[model samples]
Target: MHKLDTKLIQLCKKGNEVAQMQVYDKYAQAMFTIACRYLINEEDAKDAMQEGFLKAFVNMDSYKPDATFGAWLKRIIINQCLDVLKKRKIEFSNDEVENLKVVDDDNWDFDNSISKQNILNAIEQLNEKHKIVVQLYLVEGYDHEEISEILEIPIKTSRTHLRRGKLKLQELLKVKYNEARY
Candidate 1:
């Protein structure tokens, strides 16, 4: 943490409202964008972001310097979004993939013709579980272990979902590619 951030955080911990607002102002837009990614409704995303901020403030003592304050707040925001999703009864699968060999494919290469927006649209069409896993892994840059912890599934399940999601995403993109070629 920067010296300025540390000072602000110390003030926030001391229950200074102005300091809290300053911290919120610093991170709100970026955190809101992250919430929007996990939530479809703008209002719901806003609510989640607000709730996340409240939670962070109420639990300010727990904040540590091991990670950047933004990263810590980002986790809280994502967790709040996930809580909203849970209330909607979006099921995250717990199926064990013990027998299945999940290939860890690091390459997320799409054809040159496929735009970033096209890939994002394709990701949206995936099943909810696979979509979330793919979003966390690829878009959010989380490793399998982190994903497994976040989603409360086994590491193999995370890998399996990523593999399956990647395959489906490729298929979706290929169809789009062929259509454009014709």
Candidate 2:
């Protein structure tokens, strides 16, 4: 952590309300974006972000210097989002038990290039489980191991979701792009 962050954390740990607000002000927007990726509702995302901040403040004493404060807080925010989703009965399929081979490269070939917006729209239309995996792995820059831990799924399951999600995204984009050309 930078010197400023360390100072802020120390002040926050000391029960300084102003320091707590400073920390919240610094991280809230980014955290809200992360929450929105999962919740898809502005209200729910705000609620999750608030709850995350509360948890972080309450547990300030446990803050470790090993990781950046933002990273630690991001996990809490993600967990808050997941907790809300779980309460809504959102479930991931463990049914993809068969070992399906997935390509290891990022190379993609399309008949015609699709706009980034189109790709993002396709991703938004994916199944909840697949969408979350893709967002965490691709958009959020989390690795498979981190994804597994965050979602509490097996590493293999995380990989399967990501593979399947990409295939699904490709199919969606292809249809859209093909129609646009014709």
Candidate 3:
């Protein structure tokens, strides 16, 4: 945690509303973006972000200084988003999601050359299960074990979702890139 974050957290723990607002202002936009990745609706994302901030303030005692404030805030925001998704009946079937071992296409290579927008668009086009796993893995940098814990699935299911999601992404990007080349 930075000096500013430590100061803000200390003040927040002491029930300082201004300090809480300052912390919210500093992290809201980034946290909102994280929420938006999981929620298709802007309003839902905004609500989740708001809920996350409220939770953070309410649970100020749990804020350990070992991790960066942003990371801690992000986990809260992601959980809020996931909660919204769950309320919307986003189902994760163990039997259906298991063992989809799509062979990764090593020949299809994309680096910084591809536009971020293109990749994001492709990700948006993915199914909910695959998109969530992909975003959590590729964007949020969660491992299969952590993902399994978060999504409440077997570790193998998380791996299957990631593999299938990546393969689908590769297929989507291939078309877009090929179109650009020709």
Candidate 4:
């Protein structure tokens, strides 16, 4: 990653075409996959992926290897996807947004029959804030404090979003399964 860290940035900054392609080749599929996870649409995913890369390339000089290049690039793609969703005006209300607490609930059945893809699809259906808070908490395994800092929200807000997101996801999974059975 370090080899790519320096070489890619140096070539990109120098306006090297091959280096640009190299950057695209290495990260496009991965970044696109992540974007697709958010957008749940191939074309929109591609748009976000493209924009993220363009941003990353243009700002390549600002990257430091203190973190993996892939991690940095992935953040860009996620932010791009989030931006698209935000533009759609899907958001949470104040009442729903007020509560933010994370107590381990013994009732969550991780052993349930819900297929991973179904769960992922349900997550994709969430509004941008809920979708991202869910992803950061459950998928990425980030703690509330980390999530709060990352998302620029209060700790309580992070907890609230996570709680609401999980409850919604469970409801979504139940509905989809029941519909399928019928």
Q: By TM-score, who's the top model here?
A: 3
lDDT for 164 (candidate 1): 88
lDDT against the true structure, per candidate, is 0.90, 0.86, 0.86, 0.78
Q: Return the TM-score for each candidate structure.
A: 0.90, 0.86, 0.92, 0.77
Ranking the candidates on TM-score from highest down gives 3, 1, 2, 4
Could you tell me the TM-score of candidate 4? 0.77
- Name every residue pair that clashes in candidate 2: none
Q: How high a TM-score does candidate 1 get?
A: 0.90
In model 1, which residue pairs have backbone atoms overlapping below 3 Å? none
Model 1 spans with C-alpha error above 4 angstroms: 95-99
Relative to the true structure, candidate 3 has a C-alpha RMSD (angstroms) of: 2.3
What would the per-residue lDDT of candidate 4 be over residues 21-119, giving only the tens digit for each residue? 988898899888888777877999999999999898788888787888888888888878877876886554435554345556334564366788888
Q: In terms of lDDT, which candidate is strongest?
A: 1
Q: What is the lDDT of candidate 1?
A: 0.90
Mark the regions of model 3 whose C-alpha exceeds 4 Å error after superposition: 96-112
lDDT of 4 at 152: 63
**Cα-based lDDT at residue 167, candidate 4:** 85
Residue 175 displacement (Å), model 3: 0.6
lDDT of 1 by residue, 89-176 (tens): 9876656667778685699988999999999989889988898889898888899999889878788888988988999999999999
